[model samples]
Target: MKLTCIAVDDEPLALGLVCSFIEQTPFLELKGRSSSAVEALKLLNDEVIDVIFLDIQMPDLNGIELARVLDARASKPRIVFTTAYNQFALEGYKVDALDYLLKPFNYEEFLRAAQKALNYKELINKPAVAEAKSEDEYLFIKVEYQLVRVALSDILYIEGLKDYVKIWLASAPKPLLSLTSLKALEERLPARRFMRVHRSFIVSLDQINSVTRNTLHIGDINISVGEQYKDAFNGFISKWN
Candidate 1:
């Protein structure tokens, strides 16, 4: 299937080049092009865009902010960030971008990024098999530039540090670090298997060694329950008592 996209960049030349690349690509269909993030948001709302060829550094809203806005929506396009700077690449992971184009990149690099978006579309669009598991047993999180697949059963707990999170696992001594928000990961995790007992911690229900009035023990790690999430934790506690 052809993945529909909108080219977004503040520079006229950059915009034209991306639009041109979109047109040349066999599987990508260019639905629109915008020089501003605000205008791009409007166009995105009006159409069912599959992907966005977005430039990260822009005037006004900027690409990263625009990506977060779209992330809030029920349906949002996969982002392929286009930027001249390597420094801003990590920010792209916070929004779960599919791929990114480093500036002064050749058509080959752009085509590779487009192909990645198309593969993602195909994966999501594939029809579910009758025997397909109802719940996902694993999660693939973006770690820097690569997607790291972690098994749900292996995760002991998670630690949040605003823009990044650390996944503590049973298999490894070191925790896996990823560029994403705790709230974002919380939404994706299975409710029955995981719970956010603290603002900074999410514990695997099966991995809990013990729970007390304010603290939870997972192995030797003592995680304090946050006041904001007390009621939910209490509900889980009540299930056992």
Candidate 2:
């Protein structure tokens, strides 16, 4: 996912340098550049900023003061203090700053701070899945920016990608993609109906068409059972015999 950011520094050279660093990073998008904390607040009010690369020493309302204002807000952007003075580093963390970059930092330092922001963003904003009812007949899967409801019975299998998963269904040819973890989905699923056969896959027990040596045929595809899960799967199969 891409994070929208803004640089707030009083010095022209510092502001330009930070902006340039943001532009150079592939996953980071530079939305605005402000010369002072007041200007940064104006931009923040007008736009949705994901992270702020802020300098602590500005006239009138300084970066520390600006950070205090943002910290109180319900949906404030993450802050990364960038200043020549190192004394404010302790204060910066009190506001939960993602990272602290001293002035005259190189591209490596900038990228590391940006990467930390990205991790924080993903951790807090990843799509959440929740059961729709007490009966567990249906559930909501957050896809992109919207929550999509799908029947539990309709789920044939689930294939997990990194930080995301694809839900194969009996009703649709294409799988439903969602930004969530396999482990998270597994916890929400009914233990009796859904079973984790592999680290990357969870299958609907009732949807299985057939079972081979170490694989299952569900819908029109075959999924191999993971080595760690073989004994449990075998024990589950023994119930049928």
Candidate 3:
């Protein structure tokens, strides 16, 4: 998933460095850069930012105060504070900042902080995502600009492409296509009902017809079990029998 980010710092050099680092990161998209926390708020209002690279010591409005204001919002971006002081670390955590980056930090340090923010974003968003509905035993997935609902029981398997996934359903003649990564979808699936048999395939455990050696049969179709996933598949089969 690509996370939208903005860098906020009083120092031109510091903000420039962070902006450069953010641009180089594959999964991060730099939305804007701000010289102060007040300016960052204006940008936040205009765009849906996923993460903020904020500096704690700013004039007019400090990063800590800005974070508190953001926390009150219904939909708030995750904060990663970049400050020279180590004393504010405790206060940063109290406000639920994702990470604290001490000044003089290298690209590696900045990258680590950014990654933490990315992870925190994913964790917070998973429950809010429109992927699962346990009460109805169905999920609504975005397919070609439309939200399509598919019954859990009707799902045969899911095939992962590089940037998209094909959802194979028992009743549908054609598989449904959606723009989402396999790892993202897998996290939303019910562990008891589905299993990742290969890097490219996630099969419905209830829909499996049989298994022979390294291949699993779903109706007449055969899917090879990945070496890395073999142990988990074997454990699943053992429990089933």
Candidate 4:
């Protein structure tokens, strides 16, 4: 699929380099170029873009802020951050960017990042052809007063409080906290992809890195498997082993 992109960078040379790379790539089409975030906003309003090649550091509004603004819209294009700064990588993920490309990056790296954006675009646009199982393979949760759709594949783990569930996603920084019972959530999730390792936690099987007798490592978080759930957990471990 072809991707229509806009390049936004304060530096003229950086902007030119992105344009050159887009010109060389067959699947990418450079739709617009902006030296500032304000100009980029205008361009986005005028045209239909699939992805944005954004630079973190700009004169006035930065790329991160632009992403936030875009995210507030009904339909927003995917973002691929292209910047000289490495410190913003975490922040880039916080905004659900497709990928982060450091400045002076080679064609191969650019292609790889661009491909990720293309893949995400396809996933979003394609119809859900798979039949809905008795248990949910995904969730639609409210975040910032909007119902955000998240696939089971994107979830790392679910942390439960008394009357709330905090969803830790693979792509974002803050967990999405909602007023939902862990018991209610467990009933909705697919048994194959999710397992209740703890009374307070339900983790995605694909996101599990390792497990000890008591704890399962999901990314940087260490979650304890409750004693009550040990029987089922052991059964799951046996299957994988």
Residue-level lDDT for 123 in candidate 3? 47
- How does candidate 2 fare on TM-score? 0.54
lDDT of 4 at 33: 99
lDDT of each: 0.88, 0.86, 0.88, 0.84
Q: Judge candidate 2 at residue 181 and give its lDDT.
A: 88
Give me the candidate number with maximum TM-score: 1
Question: lDDT tens digits, residues 38-154, model 1?
Answer: 999889889999999999889999999999999999988999999998888777876889887899888999998888787677766666762145236878777764556689999
Off by over 4 Å in 4: 131-188, 191-200, 203-241
**Candidate 4 structure quality by residue, lDDT tens digits, 1-241:** 8999999998999999998998898889999999999999999999999999999999789999999999999889988899999999867866767778988899899888787677666656665554344126567664432245787888999999985789999988989986667898888788988999887899998999999778889878899988999899888888877
lDDT, candidate 2, equals 0.86
Least well predicted 10-residue stretch by lDDT in candidate 2: 126-135
Judge candidate 1 at residue 109 and give its lDDT: 95
3 against 4, candidate with superior lDDT? 3
Pairs of colliding residues, candidate 1? none
Please give the lDDT score at residue 175 for candidate 1. Answer: 94
Per-candidate Cα RMSD to the true structure, in Å, reads: 4.6, 11.8, 13.3, 9.2
